[model samples]
Target: MLPQERQKEILKLLQEYRSMKINELSKQLNVTRETIRKDLYEMEDKGLIKKVHGGAILNKANSETNYDHRKYTNYIEKKSIAKKAAELVEDGDTIYIDYGTTALLFAKELMSKSDLTVITNSLPIANELVNYTDFQVVVIGGTIRKNEKSLFGPVANLGMEHLYVDSGFFGMGAISSEAGYTNFHMGESEVSRRMIKHSNKTVVIADFSKFNTVAMNKVASVDDVDVLITDENTNQEALKELESIRTRIVVAEIVEDEKSVE
Candidate 1:
């Protein structure tokens, strides 16, 4: 990878793990330790991370952690879920997309659609659709979250009032029968609640990892959502629990999307 691209990956790892050894980073990045050290030096100079004895940690200037949303553990499953979720959006439908990694993938899937309105608080998601003339992209106004490339606060909610969303597709940290929907960040939870209120149908695009794992902030419960899109690898017990909640569960086939491979 290029120097710039490699550094970005380093930063993302630091953000997720908080700190990692030079050796570990080299192993993960598949680069020489000297190269990793040079990248770390550059990141330290930029104030993005602080170099410690053997590794680096995120700059603690801010209280909240802003992790960049990217492809995660369940790559194939999330891609399948995202592709299936895209089908739920018909022509000319206005949808509210969350600022989650899966939601970003779903936004990319919508690129082929010629007539659609997408309202989002995610800067990355908005950027994905910004150049597409066929998409009417409305990025909500709010306090900018630099790390996650998302928006939050009251203004984001105010904008949602004028929007009548056909569907609100969200990515949550966890979805439990008890806790409902939960997110890692409190600000994201606030934005999701507003989207859910404005949406006629609320759809949560999640991999099985989210099931039964509750995060810090609760977004909503299975009772509030209209559909749950997940992969087949999810445990039968978890699926049974969802069925008991009476939520419409849509299992996305876990085959690789040919479009992605192409």
Candidate 2:
């Protein structure tokens, strides 16, 4: 197959399955291992995927294409992650949440709290916080990301500039040792990066599916975040890769009772 055809196939598989080994991809595409490796390298540099020891993982969601599909993809784990991340916040602490689906779950968990200073660029997150009028929600000013119902761009960053937070809760398109934390949306990425830059502590909230991938734009590295809140499906190998970089990993235990969030 042509190089573009092969790369396209590789990305399609990665987005669906998250990661694929070099040998498997080679066999499936009727290409040599060397060819697959080169393709991964090019894609990695483009921030489309993260090349691992034996495979590549898709880094970011297709954004426009998969936003809805991803919303319910890992509901249980997302809720678990969101809970664990919320535990890190004190009742009065100020926090930053982004537009990722996992972050939306985090927003839901925040609803149980009454005295929080929640700041975000996500319209969904803002709407979720509405029921808790006791919490102070700061919506960042920016252009709308219509398909995703979030805001991004320079005005958002400017809004972020004026505030500092105790914690910044973020979601990922993909994260791996090779690519760090990556995303497809530059405007959103910029907003998260600013939160990272300004927060007293930065935390990345993602499910296991995001562990080994690299997305189109980088948000930050393991060194940037103070904690990683994920779930049990995150394998040891992936944990080792993250731990190797010294990012503190917290594998959230899924609780059956929703009321337990309080």
Candidate 3:
């Protein structure tokens, strides 16, 4: 196939599965791994897709915003929520960070602080804290989920059992009055639950879009979370309901840039 045609086909596959591994693409497209890598690089240059370690993913999959196309959606809202969540962490505290895009943002905000112990199951989060000499980073080892860059399964949970943290910053695929907090994958749900169990306080970081949505697996109940930090765009009715359940909610306001219209 022509280069353009091959690239188009690859994008189509990515849209269908939301993600595709290099070897999987090679076998399906009847091409060499190097060729697939070149195609991925070209696609990334065009902003058509994102390249992960072993594969490329559709940008809309999740918030990490690195290998996904979802950065554009609720961008300001997520940043605000992340900022509010960051304020909850104090110097000389050990915190657990879950593997979610919003949680990654929280990690970034915490990087400038001094004397922190960060325990995480996210490779990206661990990498982000590597340059901060005063911060101690502990990565829970487990079976790696290539798509999300997170470690999960029995090994990860076992590792988490022995560690304790002052607080946990977690994000969810969806949150609803009925389901509480949910995730798209079962393994991710397990990791989130384990993080909550290991921490003294659990703060959930999410944007307005997460409210009223439901995912495949339940991570924790609303009661399980100590605080819910979200953006101002969240529905008032939902906020009222959360309050009725005695869930502490913090709404982060959006700050517009000076270049934008007031």
Candidate 4:
């Protein structure tokens, strides 16, 4: 078969199922694994797909923005929350960062801290701390969730059991008086639950928008969270309600940008 035809077939298969391994493609296409690998690499460079550890997945950028997009969604708010959350960390502390956009910001904030052990299921968070020699980074092994670019499943939960930390910073999809804290993805939620159980203290970092929105799974309750960090945009009424439940709330002051006034 012609190379172009083979590539087209591969694209068709990926479109149907979203992802496929090189070995699977080889068997399906009656091609050698090396040939399929080369084709996948070429497709990845062309922006036709994304290459995973053992396979290729249809690019989900248009449907779901990757970590970079999420990291910048509420840039100012996230930065403020991260900054405040960082103050809770002391030198030589062990921390478990859950996989979420907000937790990714927390990892960035921790980049300057020295002599800390960081455990996480977030690839982006782990990569951010890679250059910091003083910080020890450990990643949990599990089934990688393509949309979120994080690890989940039993393996990841098992990896988390090996260590207890001073604090665990988590991000929630929604926070409400009724539902408490929830997540959109079930696999991710399971990992978050494990992290909360393994930590001495649990801090939840969320933006103002997350209030009142409930997702698929509930990770914890208002009582489970030791501290709640958010930006100034958070509603005063919600803050009062949170405090009533004995959840300490910290609102980060926003720094206005003067250049926009011109």
State the number of backbone clashes in model 3.
Answer: 3
TM-score of each: 0.72, 0.76, 0.73, 0.73
Candidate 3 least-lDDT 10 residues: 59-68
Clashing pairs in 4: none
What is the C-alpha lDDT profile of model 3 across 1-262, one tens digit per residue?
A: 9888888788778766888999999999999999999999987765457899999986442223342444455667777788788899999999999987778777988866789999999988898888889999999999999878899999998998889999999988878776688776668789888789888999999998887765545789888888999998899899888878879999998755412210
1-262, model 2: which lDDT tens digit per residue? 7887778788878866888999999999988999999999998876677788999876544433556766767677888898888888887888888897888888887766768898888898898887687998899889998877889887887787889998888888778887789876767888888889989999999888876666666799878988988898887898888888888999998765643322
Q: lDDT score of model 4?
A: 0.82
Task: Name the Cα RMSD for model 1.
Answer: 11.7
Better of 2 and 3 by TM-score: 2
Off by over 4 Å in 4: 1-66, 257-262
As a TM-score, model 1 comes out at 0.72
Error of 2 at 124 (Å): 0.5
Clashing pairs in 3: 59-68, 59-69, 59-70
The whole-model C-alpha lDDT of candidate 2 against the native structure comes to 0.82
